[model samples]
Target: MLGLLTSIMRVFEIPMAFLQRILGIKHLAWVFLAPNLILFFLFAFLPVFLNVVYALTGGDQILLRDRAFVGADNFAVLASCDNYLDPNTCQKDLFWRAVHNTGWFIVLQVGFMIGFSLLTALVLNRDIRARGFFRSVFFFPVLLSPVVVALIWKWILQRHGLMNAGLDAIGLEPVLWMLEREWTFFWSVFLSIWAHMGFYTLILLAGLQAIPRDVYEAALMDAATPFRTFYRITLPLLMPTMLVVMVLALIKGVQTFDEVYAFSGGGPGSATTLLIQYVYETGFAGAPRLFGLASAASIMLALVLVVLTGLQLWATRKNADG
Candidate 1:
């Protein structure tokens, strides 16, 4: 039998080798990955290096025309309250405010979005009537354009709009949802959660559905309760998907801009302002824009997001392995 197997292998060797060579699968790794590598170098790495260079330079000239090499000056100004351009001392500058607001928004919006998505996914994944309709209703918001969603909410949340009209029907007074600083930030968080939860729900529902029914059956054979079966069988199996959903949500939440921009314009005294919005306002809104500062802020935001995502990935990987 061994000799016959060897003879068959020798007979097939020539044809197999020829097929492999013809397909170039021996070099398939390079062929498959070369395009992605080129794209990453061009779009990701080059922009990051350029931003770092811009952050280190001075005079707001991003093209380096007549620009001086002011090493660490921009970072120093950002760290301290001393503005190089202004003679008078500004108590709270754009940099710190943007950072603080972005941190708060990420925490609040991501928490609510993930929590709500998980609950919705759990419900939608169960054997309920009209499950498809409910799933469609839940996920429909993700199909809407962020700008359009923001505008629709803007109209609805306005003083004399649908929200207040509903409230008046119940004999309640109209609340200025976007006029005050606190409410502006609250509504921004609300809108973010509303818009983003749909995608996360779909992701988690897919994860839940992919769990093997045999595992739950085995748990039941062991006399495990429903909650125990869920905790033991469902959650452990769902770890990989949960990690992915969390990472994507974190990245998106950190880079939130469109809805906030279209709805509030970072107004009510910059209450709903985020880092990306601040970067845009600094780079393009003012008469004479501060491109250097804006680039520095953008780079900083990117670094923060990278660090957070890396931490999350590490933690999830460790949990999965265990």
Candidate 2:
């Protein structure tokens, strides 16, 4: 056994030694990874480590002098329905309500956005006349900033805005689009869907274009109807792109803050108060800022996002495999 091992090592050792010398393999590996290592530690790892520490500390302040270890008290307080700082008002406990509202928002907005975008992509991908012009027109909204889109929609949904003006022009009363709770929430969903659908449509359109034309022709020759071809060929092939779009929309929808914040300010009785905005308000808006609580909430929100993304990726992979 020792003689055999010695012979094998001798056979391979020369090439290994040559490679180490020529490649400077030890240093070469680090050279390839050094920039990414520095960036990951600086931008990604450090902030997350610091935020975890911050979440475990007490007090309304984040300055090192004011922070002290309080263990899981902040998290516990947040988990409870009762307010951490104030005992009297349940409305002041923004964490639970924010979670619930954000969940609902993701469900409704993402559902509509993905469906609408897929439909639009299908229509645009067909060989209709002036298809390029129509595709460009449909996707134009995606180029606008979220704040700009929000403000534009705010004007359109306001009582004296374009929508109301049109209603009045038609000899009807100008309904309060943003002043009422139900209408305001509905308008928020509408605007979010409208603004975001364009980008997803563009993404799906690119995916649609990538599919080989021969597959469709083969399906046609096989006597597959359009719907059957789409189900068996187009959808299966498009799963990769659809998965990507779904994950992107899910992440964006859950973290949505600016649009709702700018549109109604989560108004008409906290109708659109998403988790991120709630965290912002808790940390910065009120007197005696609850930095620890806000950090805890932020950590929870981050965890929720991570878990959701993980589940989506896993489910999509399983479906693809099966």
lDDT of 1 by residue, 158-244 (tens): 988899899999999899997989998999999988888989999899989888888888888899998897788888888787777
Where does the lowest 10-residue lDDT sum fall in candidate 2? 83-92
lDDT of candidate 2 at residue 82, scale 0 to 100 = 52
Report the poorest 10 consecutive residues by lDDT, candidate 1.
83-92
Q: TM-score winner among the candidates?
A: 2
TM-scores for every predicted model: 0.81, 0.83
What tens-digit string does per-residue lDDT give for candidate 2 at 1-322?
9999999999988876776688797666765687999999999999888888888888877695778899999888877655534423444456676776787788899988989999999999999999989988887888888899899998888878999999999999989889898788888888889888988999899999999999998888999998999899999988888887888899889888988899989888777788998889888886678777788889998988898799678867875675
For model 2 the local lDDT of residue 53 reads 85
- Give lDDT: candidate 1, residue 273: 83
lDDT of 1: 0.83
RMSD of 2: 9.1
